[model samples]
Target chain A: MHGLRRVPENLSGRGDKVMEDKYDVVVVGAGPAGSTAAYSAAKNGARVLMVDRRRELGVPVQCGEAIAEDILNELGIKPDRRWAVNRTNAVKIVSPSGIEIRISEKKVTGKVGYVLNRKVFDKFLAVRAVKAGAEAMIGSYVNGLVFKNGRIGGIRGVGLDGKFEVAADVVIAADGVGSRVARWAGLNTALRFDDIETCAQFQMVGVDFESLSMLEFYLGSRISPGGYAWVFPKGDDLANVGLGVLGSRAERRPIEYLRDFVSRMPGLSKGKIVEVNVGGVPVCGPIEETVGDSLMVVGDAARQVNPLTGGGIDSAMRAGTIAGEVAAKAVEEGDTSKERLKEYERRWKEAMGKRLTRYLKAKEILLGLSDGELDKLAEVLRGVKFDRISLTDMLKVLVKANPKLLWKLRGLL
Target chain B: MEVDSSLCLRCGACVSICPVDAIEATDSYVRPNERCTDCGACRKICPVGAIK
Candidate 1:
């Protein structure tokens, strides 16, 4: 029989050097990846510390704020008061020639995604992480990594008052697109300018609109060369109008393109701009390696954004959950080595990786096509009913529209 | 206003979207004036969430 664990006499002692707190895990960047990692880790009975560089967890909102409802349910997170904007039921894709193809709302998983209030939604996720027993830190800028025997130990960051270090068995890198943590840890995540897309968006009010229920997407080189524009309805006569342009074409600039498009639209021209936002989306392939020696990366930091849509939230959450389980297991086994952490890459690749690879390939092929070719393709597609269109059906249409392009797509298709 | 040079793409997105012409593209950055309405247009238009 084991005696009751003796209580240390230093419950309130002055000689005590305040034993440095050590968490099971330390998550950097309190975005979707970090927050999800923290929540999951804490739920597994591991201590977690979540940090964000901003003074506030989420504000000065960014992101399209669109996430699939199926993903939300899978993560066990419900739509709360804070981030709920509206449930999206349908999507309209307008071709360069102004031909529109509407995809109706058919809930395959009995779920429809919501257009969120990002700042609020982000904070809500952070709050959930905290509720799950993770310590939350804001306005904390991570200065560098802590290492032990050539393996990652934890992180060091500066808060409002003083600098401090958090020690943990594992570190989760969720720092967004420009994150350097993984690179610093010797995980290569180099990205090229062409792989990036510079995007701009605005929250506008007082605009007269029809059918507030649908999300409209405009595609064509004329509107946005190597990119497209979107108008996401935010209710109350408000909308988030945005554009994403290839970063290589930095000369045109996203806002300039947005301005030119908005000026031409009578429905949008009347709206008064209440907010402006800008960000860059990585429209390239995923990072080659997502884990190494007690470390894992998720979300935009890992270059996991959709190559075509530039949407990352849902994927990030999924990746984060996977990262959490792997990191926690690594900690429990006392082996945070690269071999053990390789599970993260294996898990994500097996699950979402295949789909992402397919989409990335499609994006590359589509980007190589000429404006005339795209217009012709769009014209052909306008005749087909979207209800009957599957991936193969769409490919058939493309093949019929341009037989010459078929040979080039042999490898990709 | 000071643009953190690290994140500024200097793509002139702000200058292009400025309805009041309060922002201009300088050699290194987008310079804003007292005329800046803080309408948050530049903030929304930035692709990297660079503007506040």
Candidate 2:
């Protein structure tokens, strides 16, 4: 039991553990957020280390595999040849009545995003981090934090063969939704039932499509209450179709809703499911704050995913970059305490936090709307034709029934 | 089968996000089982991914 401080398994006498490794920073988890954070910090002259409990990084890939192109540019990371399944120029919004509208008009600047190959994509990001001089330790399970003076010191974890301890000046909690790192560091992240989106997804192989270059989003209460269903083409006649319902209203299993949705839809139901994947996305605004002494949180851990659209790859990458930079800056100033690290919270909020707050409020208002109201809103928008309907203007009309929403609608419009 | 008590801040993020509700908090740890679909939602939504 070397290096294992607090043995979690009820195994007898597991506390007598010890391995010695050290770094300027240690990041747990090897998903997009973690890899990016590790890469950024290591590139900035920090002795960084990253770990993942899984034997492999990208196996059993669990994401919708949708990512924005612009985000890739900001990170100076290019999508490798093996990571792209298909490219799309537009995203079609389909109403409950089956009305369809294409939101992109041009070629380069159109609604552009990628349907990725997660196996390759996940590995690609981590490899970049390694290339930047960060050490990657796979199959290492981080069991707890090592603390000193009530400040975060490092992580205590185990591998397939042995246990180890890695001390660091800071820890970036890019560990994802069930992140224990943030809580252990003394930050609060409890979520309400209504704030979560329980999701179910299926990878279908035999689906024939009218169009393969565009992603389709279906909006209707009969299908997904307080959420929407999506069809993202993954090529080779395959597509990833899924839906998310508010956790509080999720009475039945997510698969049941997904099955009903695909079977009823004309184009989607024709295919057979080759793979089934289920997950959840935190569609709320950021936590009250995501920084504490000697620690910071990023990606889903920070609750930066868009509540309305449930898209997070772009935002998570953005958050990872911020966390990495702030952690490095904190080290430079020799202030690992939470008070000086508040800049991360402030900078993140100023950059993307404001929009997330608005999006969360908008989602609450949108979820409360009735099916008839949605149909009416869709109809009104159809009546008011334009090359592209301004989303803010359209939302204003949709939220007219709620005065509180109206009051909050000033700067948004 | 093992949960870091220090990591489990009792945020209930796992309880709320688990598709099958397999995660339940005892006085000390959050427990799950074969009933869990391994959707990884709890893992993903976990502010710390502490479920591992």
Candidate 3:
């Protein structure tokens, strides 16, 4: 009676005791995307509710925890010392032939990055949403959607309280890869095995020499098939060593590749393993649809990720912010129709569309290259200075340096 | 790629990966349309191994 609001306890119509299950906006999945959307929506005066099935927020980190500095700035997330584990400036791209090419962070845009303590960074985002008047509940499993007049109306699931359905003016699905929520809502959110990178990472301590000042990448089909291996130092001799393999090309598990990868790296081989993380990252181009009726899907659910690099945190945040703003405005206009939610798709496309399209084209070409071709690619990129090292930029450089080797890829350009 | 239909969670991973937009998913089944080139990209990502 103290903290509970009364409504229908159940549709069975027993006694009058019930809980209020209504909000202006409901966001499923309390990761970066969900929290950002909740924050944006609440900031714009939409009473928001965020839910996640995780018993604790940000635990069991699933990513490499690397974020470009500009991505953080794009989302207006300030550089906070607390969540940032390492301020990385140097980066090296190693070829199949053991050729190492150092790329300056300032020269290659987005190369200037940080290795985050995601356990803290993710929670910080959810806290920001709560501070903005958005309420969040963990341990809530949203099993299905509530449809009204063929439009998304709310969510139904078992939570700490029990099985219940909550109503909302809009439902924002920010669930990550393998999003059943998106599927249940009649949306296509699947990644072809070829378009997905099954990644595994290990946090290892006692890493040998060299400053935690650089992020490194190793490329070769032998090492990771269609994906690559990385070493992201978290400072204090603790580093995340990981490898991702194209799901289709993976003969064994991605973890096997990571284990083999770790043993090869002198800095990682002997280090003591502390934490291991495994997950599926979608690398497909943007989905054909992102919104329908009163529903707006943001982040990975919409495939708002870089097709070339398996990174989505920044894109997720950006999409979430836009979804929140658009949802709030739609609510104020009393239009939660499909047409109204289309504005969210429009804004995010304007912001991140071109880059993603270019990346997708580039990814197709990269997948077609062999390890020997990759070595040649490394050779051509040695002396090049990258003001902004994007897939488009890389493709241009490759075509220019090795005209014959990559002439077939010119059509994409 | 063959659509088992039974194992298909209808997640659409295959439908989205069709290079030629060959696959479509209904509430019950996922199948390749006339446009299918049989590139097999969709079968690779099916979580349930519904497609082969």
Q: Quality of candidate 3's docking, in CAPRI categories? A: incorrect
Rank list by TM-score: 3, 1, 2
lDDT tens digits, residues A139-175, model 3? 6667679998777889987666667788999999987
lDDT of 1 by residue, A54-157 (tens): 65555545566777777888987788756878777767778877777766555563346678888888878877777776777666677679987877888886
Better of 1 and 3 by TM-score: 3
Considering lDDT, which of the candidate structures 1 and 3 is the better prediction for this target?
A: 3
Worst 10 residues of 3 chain A by lDDT: A2-11
Q: Deviation in angstroms for A336 in model 3?
A: 0.8
| Segments in model 2 whose C-alpha atoms lie over 4 Å from true places | A1-20, A383-390, A393-411, B1-52
Q: How should the candidates be ordered by DockQ, best one leading? A: 3, 2, 1
TM-score of 2: 0.83
**Candidates' interface RMSDs, in order?**
10.7, 9.1, 7.7
Per-residue lDDT of model 2, residues A1-413, tens digit only: 11122222212222223223777778887788888888887777676777776656765555678876779877777666589778876667778777766655365445457899887887788877777767777667777799877767899866655778888998988877656677667676655667777677889978866577777888887788778888999996799998887766765655678899999877788888987665567787778778888788888877778888888778887877777777877787788788887887888888788788778877876787777766666765554433332467566654664455465455555
Estimated TM-score per prediction? 0.83, 0.83, 0.84
Question: Residues B7-43, candidate 1, lDDT per residue (tens digit)?
Answer: 7755444543444546544333456766688776555
Q: Mind giving the per-residue lDDT tens digits that candidate 2 earns over B1-52?
A: 3456665444445754555546644224467756677766665544333566
